[model samples]
Target: MTPFLEFDLRMIIVDRLEKSYGGRTALKGISFRVHRGEVLGLLGPNGAGKTTTMKILTGLIPATGGRASVAGFDVHEQSLEVRRRIGYLPEHPPLYREMTVRGFLRFVAELRGVPRSKRSAKVDRAIEQCGLAEVAGRIVGRLSKGYRQRVGLAQAIVHDPEVLILDEPTVGLDPKQIVDIRSLVKGFGGERTVILSTHILPEVTMTCQRVVIITRGSIVAEDSIANLTGRGEMGERMAITVARDLDGVASTLAGIPGVIGVDRAPGEPPTYHVSVERGFSGKELLSAAVVQSGCGLLEMKTVPETLEDVFLDLITEEHGVAA
Candidate 1:
């Protein structure tokens, strides 16, 4: 008997995209592809062309040169169709202040081409999904920033597009609102392709499936969150507390084949935090060596690499090179 197989489609495709403003290059031939059912994070410091790239992809602005497609439609040729298939949540979401929440969403639903008969149902569904039912009748201008943000999100999803391009979705919201919005974003990860641009590092770590790191208008790294911060890219950090003097530990660990650097941490008994140089498993090697050595290896622990570390490492390297 044969088994059935399913494959996800490609959501966004960009190649050799270039954009310039007043002779200043914003995106220097940037390129990347995002797969369907995955949240791709557009991460970079300020002025790294994240906005430029997003604008080009969403058909908000034309690229100076190169090609892109959204949901199998060419951005240059079939922009309207592309727009219909994608929902864009810009950094500063455009909202009509004078309209009530329900009225605003109904207007947006109509604007996005929802069928006349289904517009009400669509609006109701969007409001419910975005947790806007209580504030549905209130004027948008009177709503809080967090509620307004949800209104922005509601408008974006009113048409039930296949792709969602979110720029700083959690901006200006309280911690609770941020968590709520992030949870909603994560819910769409395996159903629709999400292109999320955010400065919040934890949001990316928590919600995104893949991360694209850009620096100086170019892609410096692109990989899954797990692989990007895994033991290979960032060597494991092992902390060992022992009852001994802090002499020659750095050099001794550095002498080990895969050990990179060892630094003495300030504490009562003294501890050495070691960085594994190569991609070897530090847990087994460190435990075995510590047992064999005469030093009383009181405690040893491994610190997992996080997205924050990866982001810091990338930007620090860029700054170092620039300097």
Candidate 2:
């Protein structure tokens, strides 16, 4: 097996993928992989080549250079095979406004080459899965934006493709609609590989198993969300509230093995933020040290780093700006 396939049966592969519009390059030799049953978030700012990458992967547009493959078939060489194995929802879903929700889905099923015997079942399944049962009989033009987005999603899945590529799926949704759509996308995990291209950081945190951050037409970082947010690092900061002398508590915590330093939190009485050294996983030792020093441990919790922090730091670094 090739090295890439040896890794984990990659469902999608982009090898030095590049795209250009006239003289301007939209993708600068980017490369990544999406493994079976994994939700990989493609995050980037506006005009950052995110949409371009999605288009290339979905075979909506041909790449200027390099190669891509879906389900082991070349996207450009075996386009039909690739399309048959993948479902695509563009940023603007191509919906026939005059068609009823059920009608649109049935049309999509036929376009996707679903067998006549299975078309009805497939259309029904898509409508139910996307929560469009109530709106199923309504005209597409009369439905709300959220329901329209659901119809788009239903059509994409009508053929039951193995890979689902959604571009800004919840772009125009309300808060509740966004939440509902997120739940639906999360449900696709472990059954279908998904490439979710969006600018919403929280959506990635809630739905994606791994993230690929691109900037200025190139990939800047690719890793699991935890690792990207520094959660995987051995060095950690934990907040602890104790009912004792702040000086004594700080001193005691600093003395614990692996406890590097302790500082009083600004304007917070009896609470100290403890910094643990790298390679240390000694929360228990710190707790024991606190109690032994006559400091009552009221509460102790680790401070988690957010994805927004990571995203900004990376984007800043890519632009050579001091963060």
Task: Return the top candidate by TM-score.
Answer: 1
> What do the candidate models score in CA lDDT, each in turn?
0.84, 0.87
The pairs that clash in candidate 1 are 260-277
lDDT tens digits, residue span 214-258, model 1: 877778788999888883565788888887764565566667777
Superposed model 1: Cα runs more than 4 Å off: 1-8, 266-269, 279-295
Which 10-residue window in model 1 sums to the lowest lDDT? 1-10
Q: Each candidate's TM vs. the true structure?
A: 0.91, 0.80
Q: What is the model-wide C-alpha lDDT for candidate 1? A: 0.84
**Candidate 2: segments with Cα more than 4 A from true spot:** 1-8, 231-277, 280-302, 321-323
Clashing pairs in 2: none
lDDT of 2 by residue, 18-131 (tens): 999999999999999999999999998888898998888878899998998888878887778788888989999889999999998999999999999999999999999999
